[model samples]
Target: MRIDVHAHLWTDGYLDLLDSYGRTDTATQRGTGAGATAQELEARFELNDSAAITHQILSISPQVPHFEERAHAVHAAAYANDLYAGVVADHPDRFSAFAALPLPHVDAALTELARALDDLDMAGAAVTTDVLGASLADPAFTSLFEELDRRHAVLYVHPSGHDAGTPLIADHHMRWMVGAPMEDTIAVMHLILAGIPSRYPNVRIINSHLGGALPMLLRRADDQYQWESPQTPDKPSAAARRMWYDTVSHGHLPAIRAAAETYGPDRLLLGTDFPYQNGDLLRRAVTSIHDALPGQDATTVLDRNATALLNKA
Candidate 1:
């Protein structure tokens, strides 16, 4: 019943495609999103061992080349889909896949979504917190959301270093530690506040890195905007707390506890950030969190809830 909802794997063809796009920056080449082969990932996850994970959902790391030109972005997106498909095909038992897509281009993304799901048999698609210069709530993404809703597809969102050309995120250390979380928080805010959750309630969106410090900052965000009149008629409370998050907060116990406390165990999924991080570390972190919680609640967070999310329990 062990199902890790967040993990990444890439293929050589995919790396070649990303390299051809001519838009890779420091962020794409460094950090967690840096591309690695399936064999390397298997070794990292110790998949050859008897203690290897039972199931992993592979996703293309969001740090794929980001291009302002629509045509190049479309090509990169297709390449990503192909790479993810190949990875999952190679290890159908040990892995399942979520497709990568070009966002902010509804037509291209929707077209690829059909191919990825119908042709590749992928579970869903993975998107970044933001698409180029636009947020998740941008009008351009409405059709994309509607299409995913129709398919009842899962949308996995990972943080990216995008910030409207801001120079502050150029510092790699600063960007990943601070900028990435900020990007996640802002992107989730746009989706919730802009009414995407209510409009497309069936679409399941999973945010990585424990919603990127969202559980801790949500109260401040809620309190500050409680009095301000929303542009939309729907109250933000329901949509804000209703989203899902993964437990990949670098094994920080307090952060793990805070996320569970803020969002509750029902919406939390087990995530190891595998290949980039040690799964054993994640297990230890979850164990620590379980030690602090009352009764079987700890066991639920460690595995049961994730099982329910993936329907493998």
Candidate 2:
């Protein structure tokens, strides 16, 4: 029973909202079409079937509403969460969902978070690496993190390609390919440096794209920690191990192996990034991980870990 921990779907209403704001990108547009009809969803399922995927945890891509306008952000978040609830209701066996929240607006976000979890029965919440221009470790989100930790909720950290720095290589859409991971790396570093993991130890954060550059940079972070603050109780690598990572390296075996080695198979979760990268690549990712690990470890990566996370949530 393969369970895909990372997949995305956007309701037509949400897509229309994006279009109205001129925020429709290739991924968002594809998501709009994918959620248009039952046939479209079935096509997605057919691809999952080929990959031996029995279930998926659906989430919205990082096209979260800008927090400048509180009303728009709040409405969009509620709408998206409600729409996702309907989708999950229609296909309870095939899919589950992580709700989207309006960040940078603590009160509104808290309200929606409660509604999505308590009322809508969502699996968890999907948040961007940064809220507006603020880091996830920002003090403004203290209550938010505290609440999530108290509830033992799964926090899916998706990337927005925001603040990836000046692009040196623009050819072949390098910004997205390179920038997205960089954003995730920065976000993780901020969380670690700010002591978020230690403060909110119970909040389960699943970093996307195999935790971006974290697997490779963890040793460097630890070295810096030792040199700068040896008295610190939590080392960088130790703090990183507390979080989870998804297997969505876009078919990269080395990334998967590195994450598994660093975080262990128990911390690894199977992810497809479906409707954005497609199911064929997801199948390839699954195959690659299976090839890299022992049978039981691969099984744990593919399903057991996600099941455990879901059950805990």
Q: Which candidate is the best by lDDT?
A: 2
Instruction: For each candidate, give its TM-score against the true structure.
Output: 0.86, 0.93
Predictions in order: lDDT: 0.70, 0.81
Q: Residue-wise lDDT of candidate 2 within 1-313, one digit each (tens)?
A: 5778788776666867866765646353554345738788888888888888889988876777655678878888888888888888989888888988887788888899999999999988888888766788888999999999999998999887664644463344666688788888888888888888888988989888888999999888888986775645688888888898888888877788888888888988998887666756657877888887889999988868888888832
TM-score leader: 2
Which pairs, if any, clash in model 2? none
Per-residue lDDT of candidate 1, residues 185-251 (tens digit): 7777778778788889888888887777677777776666556635643555457556788777776
